[model samples]
Target: MNDKKLELECLRLISDGSGIGYINGIATFVTGLLPGETGVVAVYEAKKKWQRARLQSIIKSSPERIIPPCTVFSGCGGCQLQHMTYEETLIWKQRWVEDALSRIGKLKVTVKPTIGMEHPWRYRNKARLHRESTGKLGYFKERSKTLIHFEDCLLISERMNRWIRLTEEFLTKGYPEIHTLTFRENDKGEGLLLLEGVPTKALSEEENPDLFEALSREGLRSVWGSDSEGNLVLIWGEEMFNQTILDMPFDVSPLSFLQVNSKQTDVLYAHVLAEAALTRAETVWDLYSGIGTLTLALAREAKKVTGIEENPYAVEDAIQNAAKNNAIGHVEFLKGKVESRMMKIEEQPDVVVLDPPRAGMHPEVVKRLLELKPQRIIYVSCDPGTLGRDLRLLSQGGYRVESVQPVDMFPWTQHVETVVCLNRKHS
Candidate 1:
């Protein structure tokens, strides 16, 4: 019933952080309700089979429940599991992966406990914030366009928070054209700013030399503005900045994809390398390789590693990174779609590594992988739903899932990064 207040017990959390409870054989999803907790909820939308509700009051809270450190944690869309203890979140993350594998993939496999951070807060190396008409920079409320401003965000470093405040103050003066601002940082505390809008007279370094100089002086090594036409204009400093992953230096542009949590990235990549167990005899193929981070890492032990990526800027960076790392000899980069470029590849890989996007690998890419039958396949996935779907297809194609390792790459969020290793089953 729409707008009906009812008491219900939360059974479990769904993929999107909503607690699911059954009411008369129908499912009721409520936000802010944790598992093992009973709460009164106001059902806003009711369907024949399911309903959506908002938690009104918690009759009983879970033992894992804790006060979120961030003042705007409840309203901000940046984090989902802040109310729960970090340990409980890790357990739930592992279960999420296991549930996906069992339900979606129909493959029973052991999922290791989620690898988590010692200090999860302030781990993110990137922040993309929305700017309101009033020049307030913050994230939107969960599932709403209503922007919520905060003095600080727990996920990003304090320096980044200052940068956001500075940028917001600048925008407050004038520059409604700039609607979005992205700030990226490296381990070295170097920052990069991306302003998504047309450069205005106020934004020009020639006119506002002090503003640009101030940003540069405040640890911003590079600043860029991109318009609707996808044209990037350098506002200040160098075009490329540096980031080190696993003791390897990478030239990262504002556009390149990088794992946000620098500490957990090290843990994730180290686990992938251990699972790969390369012995310098096998040829490796890194699909959907962005800037050759993993590809170059694989090259250290594999006979040869080829990276296939679509973004031209990322490919250029990967080429330069390979050269800079002295991995050029064993690593080669191909700029194209993985599904299409894989067809033209002449070398048959002994080991295949895939780090696809949230949408997962293309069907054609999965089909070709089955046809090629690489002896071992290691998949790094961000979305468990898609990972399970593709894993089912690969399982049916004569591959056996060897192991699943879930890593808490995005702390305080429902997102979990997983690394799966599968082997070709022999007849």
Candidate 2:
């Protein structure tokens, strides 16, 4: 233990696996280890508290280890389980949610098997690439500022991969210093790329005419401007082709908080709606409603739906989307935090749908929901840790979890989305 550079062999990957190895009695996170594999990890930094290490070499390889499909697998920090087998990856993700609920939520409940994607690869409908000063476009390194240049990303759709290649060609042809690129795929399979950068003094509309022309040739719908104030403005497009609809139609702006996986979002929304079981007489309240996706969906079945959101822009967009869908009469937009605004509502809803952020519901908000005491509650969560914690609190206040279903929103990733339906326990 007193050795300056101790070499420890990594045996297997544990639950908190991110390819980070562990040194016995050192408690340091080291990378480059697979389950049942043996690798010598060199401990460089150590304290009376803990130790850190880097993998020197792989002494033995695990049978479960497979060659990563992405060339930039280790360099690009976008994916952690690229080296893991698909079946193993799914098992670990399901265990992660179950463990979070048992340890964090401290409740006894059944966590059903995860619903995985049919084709795990090419499931990502959107991707964000960082452009460095050297004109290299890729993802950032793990826990570092270094950019790992990549020609193709395995997680995104094939169309997005093509767009990256096309953008790289554009950059080589005297395009300005681009900072970031956001790709979004519509339901029709067309893509829109939003480029952000500071324009050079000599650059002009005439000089960039060919850039738009090239984008059009590649079948890209449009290209937007990352303006001086860091705002996204439309530079060129058909205007009509610039829109994207999730559950409702919204003028897809660069800053809007749309779901990254477009295909999975449709599935996610459908599951959420089914769990809510909205009826003609039921009035539903949707908390943390972003752009009225779930609100609009629920409005179709319920008599009325009131959506609460914090972002002013998103609330405005939600109202516009409601009007666009002709559901304005059925859905009302309330702009504010759930805890504060719930107290002032004139009427209590029959059912409440809570889809809070990763941090989960505020304790006060949970308490207020119990006070309001809706007949049923459907909780949709991206973070299992927070969801489990909130479920424990809800269970104590006369709510019993009817069912919990896990959805694979992010394929080939550790993230899992769960929808929990809770009904008031009858006497």
Highest TM-score against the true fold, candidate = 1
Model 2: residue 425 alpha-carbon error in angstroms: 2.7
lDDT of 1 at 132: 85
Q: lDDT for model 2, on a 0 to 1 scale?
A: 0.75
Candidate 1 regions with alpha-carbon error over 4 angstroms: 199-202
Taking all chains together, each candidate's TM-score versus the true structure is 0.97, 0.87
Q: Residue by residue across 1-427, what tens digits does model 1's lDDT show? A: 5577789999999888789998788899987789999999988888899988889999999998999899988788679899999999999999999999999999889999999888989999998889888899988787789899999898999999888887888888887788888899999998999888755434667877777777777788877887777667777778778999999999986778888888888898898989899999999999999998899989999999999999887898999999999997889999999999999998899999999999999999999999899999999999999999999999999999999999999988999999999999999
Weakest lDDT window of 10 consecutive positions for candidate 2: 196-205
Which 10 residues in a row give candidate 1 its minimum summed lDDT? Answer: 198-207
